[model samples]
Target chain A: MNIEIRKASEKEVPFLVRTIIDAEKSGTSILPYEKIFGLSEDETENILNSILKQNEEDCELSMDAFLVAFHDNKPIGAVSAWIEALNDVSSSVIKGNLLRQHLSMKNLINASKYWQNLQEVHFDIPVKSIQIGLVYVAEEARGNRLAEKLIKQQLEVLQKKINQKEEKVFVQVYHNNLSAIKAYNRIGFEIIETKENLDKNLLGVLPDTKKVLMQLINIKNE
Target chain B: MNKTEVISQLTPIFQIVFNNPEIQISENLTANDVKGWNSLTHMILMSNIEESFKIKFSLREINKMQNVGDLISLIESKK
Candidate 1:
């Protein structure tokens, strides 16, 4: 199969959002995007499309962080990555007036609190590093190393944009997601720390599961 | 269960857990050999295996298993 990996365009927002939601569905059901945002699937898709559309127009904030993998001109997988600092920018965009219009005050507060708790539990990422989030390969496209390729492509793009001092790339996987953890390890990421017993009520909402933070150091050249 | 019978039973577990009906299992088959045998699915596979075999694998045993052969051998020993 001819697999091509490229940055996503604004027109692909719906596809990207659907891919993300579908990917997350295979994993944990708790703390899902729908539950966290307190919005229906359609509403969540609309909000995501808005974010991608606005970011495409302004080009500020790493809003263009999605990378898509296409096989024979059909999208098969996607990975989202950006500089760690962009977290705040993206967060602000989510809390901005546009999203607030669709999201209730209670849902907004819940989402904000959950994110804040997540930050506290995950610890701080190093300065000048990129964080890869929300990686998903289509069910039909698994075991073909698409995830690794997407990550490598994202790292290559991010490495070029960042200064030489920034050499670390990190990703968080749930402790139970051993296959993802193994895949990351195979890709040169090592488990640095694990936050055990995450307050089920506060953030993860999954009892008895922990979040493990892994990082691939000195990836600028690789 | 003997090794052969264990493997016979284990094959379908893998097929069901990975959601690939055509999955063929060999002694050397690792996670790399099958599609959708990711970390998340691996845990699910283990759970299903335990349920089917009516045996529990220790954390160490789970971590030590490097291939399907090792899993079958572990199940044999447990039995």
Candidate 2:
């Protein structure tokens, strides 16, 4: 099968959103929105409509880049990254505060906080890194290394984008998703931090969602 | 490591991870080909490999391994 990973187009939003929602774990539901933020269905459509309406702003806003993997023009998987420029400019304080409020549920709260903090870390510094979030490969395509391909493409894109200031690429994986953690580990990311007390880490929504935060601090220079 | 030696080392890992003595692992066998190679078991397998081999594996290599053959190749390269 011919697989291509590229910048997702506006038309692909509905399909991509559906794919994401379908692939969601029973624990969490994926709500569509601009740049793939997990929010309520009502919030997602409102954001999508606004984005569609402002298509001509020529806005070079550096937000998260969402790339989809297409096989024979069918969307099968997706990966996302935060634009370093936006990471630098965007205010993470609100998100951080929200996560802090949810700290009672150690796992989910900590995962949220870790994700938010990493975004801030990558944004504050000129780190040529990609925050790999929402990586999903169709179940039938699980063993085919499609996730690896998506990650390789993500690294390639990040490399080209930061050619001058080039350094390394990185991603975050959930603590409980051992399969994904193992995969990421195989790909060269190391566990920089393990959030044990998920309850007191972020906005306490639920008490069961535990996750590990990993990073690829460096890559071979070859 | 020799292929036989590698398999010998891996046999215990398989037994522990899968909890099935009937499992006869060959170079071509993969998690997909096995009955209970879910994500949870996958981690157990990886942890076993790490503990037995005394070497850490990166996420990239862990995700790319498809079978016993692939695992052997990775171990050889690391050594």
| Candidate 2, residue A72: how far the Cα is off, in Å | 1.7
lDDT minimum window of 10 residues, candidate 1 chain B = B35-44
Fnat of each candidate: 0.00, 0.00
Question: Which segments of candidate 2 are over 4 A away from where they belong?
Answer: A19-64, A91-128, A164-166, A198-209, A217-222, B1-79
DockQ for the candidate 2 complex?
0.01
- Write down the lDDT of every candidate, Cα atoms only: 0.65, 0.52
Over A73-154, each residue of candidate 1 has an lDDT whose tens digit, in order, gives 8888888877743322222222233344445546654554354334344444543467787788888999898988998988
- Each candidate's TM vs. the true structure? 0.61, 0.49
Those runs of model 1 whose alpha carbons end farther than 4 Å from true positions after fitting are: A23-26, A56-63, A86-102, A109-120, A163-166, A198-209, A218-222, B1-79
Best prediction by lDDT: 1
Best by TM-score: 1
